[model samples]
Target: MTNVTYKYATVLVAIQNLRNEGYNVDFNLEENCLICGDNKYTIDDFEIEQVYRYEGESNPSDEATVYGIASKDGLKGILVTAYGAYTDSMSTAMLRKLALKND
Candidate 1:
């Protein structure tokens, strides 16, 4: 993987870890998804949730859409927060897939 990719993956992991740790973000990891902070960060328990693009026309150069599965409580909203190293042009899909396998 490229150095830039390595950096984004790191941040993604950090986000998951933070959720697991019950940080300021409110959430929990389900069997096939993660319900967190008004945002449902969707992904298998083993998958990593993150946007892989290095940059975008969006306000946040580095951004990702997180979704979670429906739970007894209900599915959380969604948050596309700014994060990771914005390189310029990169494969967001490949990066997201790689991020999922990163764990």
Candidate 2:
């Protein structure tokens, strides 16, 4: 995979810009998978297509990350998560796949 870098003024801009780029689905991480409405995707079901990390200048709580994701079955989405220990916990496989985003 090739690396793509983008600079956004804020986390909201990253989310909106990624949506404009066609990552329109909104995802929430469950204990073992990523969920969107009635659909659930396991670790093997999707890949992270892009990542945008934003750091807070005055407060760490403002730090966050935006992920552009696509599933094997043709679903595309976005996942917004916070940095550090406040992030939601994930199953090992799910964690491994998401960690690959940094590579």
Candidate 3:
């Protein structure tokens, strides 16, 4: 079993890393990235961490890895993205309330 709640700090660091890279990214650890295989990260995991999206006419077939993050409603939600597929538009108000509650 994956330790979901235990990786709070690690999840935050991953998001910060993406942000520092100039990509509009967020965190969603609820997403299971190991379904493909033991110790194997699903495409969603990479997408969430790397913030990737599909190009041309074809859309992304891979679902995103979901992580726990402070959402726009002052609640935590599973973050998802596809490079350019889904960029969350979180409200600053909700942002301020979350990310530090449990930490």
Please give each candidate's TM-score: 0.23, 0.82, 0.21
lDDT of 2 by residue, 1-103 (tens): 1344558878788888888988888998888889999999988888888877777889988777778899888878898887654235676667666653444
Q: Give a tens-digit lDDT track for model 1, residues 1-103.
A: 2111223444456447445533334344333334565545443322333323334457664455342222344432222334443223325543453342433
Residue pair clashes in candidate 2 = none
Please identify model 1 stretches exceeding 4 Å from their true place. 1-54, 57-60, 66-69, 85-103
Q: What is the C-alpha lDDT of each candidate?
A: 0.38, 0.77, 0.33
lDDT of 3 by residue, 6-103 (tens): 23234446455445545343343223332221333333223212222222346454433334333232322235444423324434432332222322
Candidate 1: residue 76 lDDT (0-100): 24
Candidate 1 lowest-lDDT run of ten: 1-10
TM-score of 1: 0.23
The positional error of residue 57 in candidate 3, measured at the CA in angstroms, is 39
- Candidate 1 Cα lDDT to native: 0.38
